[model samples]
Target: MRKTEGLLKLLSLCLLAGVLVAGVLFPVVGAAGVASNQASETVDSMSSELATDPPPLVTNVTDSAGNVIATLYKQYRIPTAANQINDAMKWALISTEDRRFYDHKGVDWKGTIRAAISNQTGGDTQGASTLTQQYVKNYLINVVNRENPLGQEKAQEQTIARKLKEARIAIQLETKMPKDQILAGYLNVVEFSHQIYGVGAAAKAYFNTTPDKLTVPQAALLAGMVNNPIMYDPWRKPDNAMHRRNLVIDRMVDNKKLAPADAERLKTEPLGVVEKAPDKPASNCVGAGPENGFFCQYVVDYLLQHGMSEDELFTGGYTIKTTMDQRANDEAKKSAEAQVKKNQPNVANTLSLVKPGKERHEVVALAANRDYGLDKDRGQTTYPLPSGVTNVTGAGSSFKIFTAAAALKQGVAGINSTIQVPNFHISQVFTGGGDQCPPKDRYTRTYCVSNATEGGSGAMSLQTALATSPNTAFVILEEQAGMGPVVEMASKLGLRNSMAGNAATGGPVDPDNENAQFRTSQTAWYGPSDNSPGKGSFTLGVSPVSGLEMANVAATIMSGGVWCPPTPIASITDRDGKPVPYKEPACEQVVDEGLANSLAVGMSKDDMPGGTSHAAAAAARWTRPMIGKTGTTQNNGSAAFVGATPQLAGAAMVFRPDSPNGGLYDRGPGNVVAARGTNGDMFGGKTPARTWFGAVSKILEGQPELPLPPLDPRYDRVGRR
Candidate 1:
């Protein structure tokens, strides 16, 4: 070419020297306004972000014993220390990206001039940016302006201004961070895939190995990806990636880090990446597996419900230590799935547990028959079956305990007080829709109710009534106790979702919901369906309910009547290992400790020979001295059982949520509510009880069997208050 002009010739000479690079170097004379105050600020801000901290690392969800169940990330990154990376990786990067990396001060001026002249002379397109400059570019896109599209576009814009800014920032970074740290950060922050990032994460993801254990070929392949990850992604373009990887090997040989013979030999080696990456980051609860998926979701929802944003959870690099007992969760999951197959579209079995403590109640598990996922055709669902009031979920007679609490509080009936129950009750006192009552009683909506069992309705104490789950007896007692007190007690004892009507959706208020018409607090469970005050079936558990809250109800009783929020996370730590403070509802004494102790004593007969769950308990071979109650809705639409020891409390519930019309508990034949493709013999005393026994027993194994607190004699008689 003829003699180059003023700027071009002068720039060429200075570029080859690599001396006075970005420091003593003169700015481009013709490139006016390229180094504005805004550009200076950009360089300074980016250098500060890098010098202070690296990019965001992955946030992990760990079970009680420290097993990672889930990973949440805006980018799949696991920042490792500079010294931790394999030397092979360092060599591979230095050889391929910048052979004069150590010699240059951030900008490879010689390479830059060569690239410019070659491109102008009809040569192949080439990049001249050194490792530090490349690191600055990636940091801007992935870390500083990760979520800002315009900022990312500006970062990658092909303009002299952009190059000048990057060169300036890279020089600043070289001055601040150690070379090793800069390299390590670049390796950590670089993207390997949309969901795979960092050498630490990418090593494990691609080869199921750690950074320190990476082989030379593996390092070469990864280093090559820095140039064009999209065009050479091994999954999408294995052949292209292989050719680029071999090129990296050749560069290593040229750098004298690898022998020519070895380079040629290694070039013939397979890409050797695993067919698919293992432990690849999956963003949501779906990655936590089928059973722990429910627990994972609970952790996410609980955090989001309590003021945590989705972006913070995914990108804030928090280590979420959940309270879930993995063993208990695994056992509970197996038990629940054993009851109803996951593929049983019409049937769902769910369980949740709360560990009872004086100060806190930790949710140990939230499990269901259905796998927690997004695929609907494969019979998967994200429904909060274990924690929310999904569908019209009624707990049947299990709610008798709530009425019992109210009765004990109001002094209407005590543990030892006797109430005679007939086969059916014609409630002259309370009135609501009574369509399930005998045809003669249905016309008056007189709140008529009957016993589910045959021939055992005689005079019985309150404790015996609970064990037998006598519906008519509880209805009469509820009438005597009053409606508002029973509903209030249920809420106080942990039936929060059932009481709120909208708490299931995580919002406490919805103006368009029935909350507008009903006294907001009483709308869900206590309010009148026909614009009246009393829910005739309140004591019968004839309302939507949450299995987790029900388990908390049992935990409330077990914790000396202290109602605590069923919190899933035990603790949260930030990237620096500093504790992140989180506050949940405080534990409060919702009922007299004496009354709860006495109720525990009264409900202990549930697994005995004469009690409703006796047969199922016997089948489970259970002998733990614990208190429990079973409930079955009319037509067997749903069944549930709440059980507890001094250590822990849990609830199991079964329903056919898929069958909309009835989700009926069709007892084999003669019931129109029979769900499709079911054995149709579901009851609280059957699958619910069996699942409860199977799961809770395993969790309670090896723990000391603490006896229930002594019954307060004041709770032995009627009308104490």
Candidate 2:
């Protein structure tokens, strides 16, 4: 007996050694021995044990007041805990998918053996996958898709090798998570239709209800869809869906999860599916609210440009709070729409409001008159047209504020300084190397400039010239200050020269290229173009700038020369509600308070009686001090009004793209009539100014009245006369 026992022990040791050798030789192969080479590779790459990581959830975007403006989702999913899900749905899924789910480890070997026998006996193919196995499969699929996009298709194939790998992962997942947690994850990651994934989304899509609110019939119907969602979609095949739902109800009754009477009653009920999939959940800003769509798009574009990847944006559940005040945004939109309706239907209008903050420049409102869509004829462009950090349009005369600021800063002129103004011509004053004229007049040593009104030229103070918006006065001022200083000053004030130049090209320009040179001379009026170096016209507002930029310019003055690059985002929080790192607003004192105050006085004069924007001032009916500039581009191609108060600043612009030379005046007869409106001719002080007033008045309705700072004593006497 002792000899026999020793021999058995020796045999057992040899067998154990042989098993160890096999494990060492084939480490990737699972114990099931059915895993494919690809599955072996996948298992070898993963941890020894797998853990459940929930899929991505929807991100929420809120306005300044913390009201949800939009919900951005990659899969339109809203995750719910296992307890939060409807009880009926949970039971139904278990009954139909895995009756022995609660009793199994992970693989349900008895069911697998039964399925194998049935298949061997010529019976229909059966699925023996436990709920845990299904969860593991879905999780692995997501992991593969995210980590190895090229191998995703092969990873999803329904082969014995894939099944064995799924079983191994399922056992590991079960060891790491509770049964209820596994069930919840499975429900959350399973696809119900093409873009519809997760039980929460499925409930909403099928019945327009939340997961916890699903009724017995609805629960059963959805539970039945897990096997073959497309084949049993109630929306596509009601009859097939009804049959599947009945089977699930029957299984629930058999498993004693539902009373036979209750099951019978549920079976009798009709599938109350929604008429249409709940307006296929929008994947991006294209589906944002009509009022918030453009702003949302702007936010999206901003994030993408700032190094946030598309995958991260879609998957990361970021909580974004923007600087937009919904009230201001609404008012701006209304004002823009009203102006568009009044003018030619095709003409575009944009209104933007900005305000100063301690840490950043706030974009309170960004509004346009068109819908945010892909239909070109219906005005689909995300208008106000973002240039770089802000939007862009022809600055026209609105740009004179920059030139005026530059002159004051350089001490080349003051609000009281006298400058010769020409009634409609100043070709003789700007005769120099950079003062080259159009090719037709190349040989002429003249660069004639004009005022919007005839017989309005003469000796005028810089303040009066600003209030009147005389093109010749500013051109002469630009020459005196030198284009270099003017351009440099504008740059310091957040006017990206390259972006401004690109705005003149009439096509989309790369906002990312800081060194991109301005290419077209026609739009050069929008900005100083390298191609057209004689920027004597720079002071005349020839460069294009967005309404937001103009508003920022005004905001800079309001902030006493502190230029804070405008930012829409107020705060960003990650999934755990922790602040994410982002670039802080770069605030710089670009101009002296004295110079800014002097310019403010000039703009304030424009809104006073006899000033060019007097009509707008009247319309605004402001009770507090306000300063503004009115701008009408050459040939009336565009009209703009930029204004600032102690508390707020805004800009409005109207463009006539189809008009002759893109002039607002040459817009169709309807536009001409709407813009003229018994005012004789459309000017910057008319439509654009009025639009700004109409919107801003509403925005400032309840705000406390604040007065602008007193002008610097040195220049107080210059423009007052």
Cα lDDT tens digits, model 1, 1-721, are 3456756856755563343244314234213553566766766687878888668777899999888999988788877889889889999999999888888877877677677566655688777888998898898888878899999999898765577677777877788888888889889888886457789888988888988999899999999998788888888889998999999999998899999998888888898888864457687788897778888988988898788888889988899999999889989988887777788766778999999877999999899888888889888888787887663547888989988988898898889899877888888667654666444343556668778767964789998988888888888888888777887888899976566554233334575665321234653446444546576777777676789999999999988889989999889999999999875878899999999899999899999998889987897788778899998877667788999988889999887566533434434322222122236546777788888998888788888878888988889887554
Of candidate 2, the 10-residue stretch with the lowest lDDT total is 384-393
lDDT of 2 by residue, 616-710 (tens): 66876855688888887665666788888887888877765433243443443234334325522346787778778888888888888887777
- Highest TM-score scorer: 1
lDDT of 2 at 187: 92
TM-score of every candidate relative to the true structure:
0.88, 0.85
Which candidate ranks first by lDDT, i.e. highest? 1
lDDT values for all models: 0.80, 0.71
Model 1 spans with C-alpha error above 4 angstroms: 1-42, 113-126, 276-281, 373-378, 435-445, 453-458, 502-520, 523-525, 528-531, 660-680, 719-721
Clashing pairs in 1: 411-719, 636-665
Query: Whole-model lDDT, candidate 2?
Result: 0.71
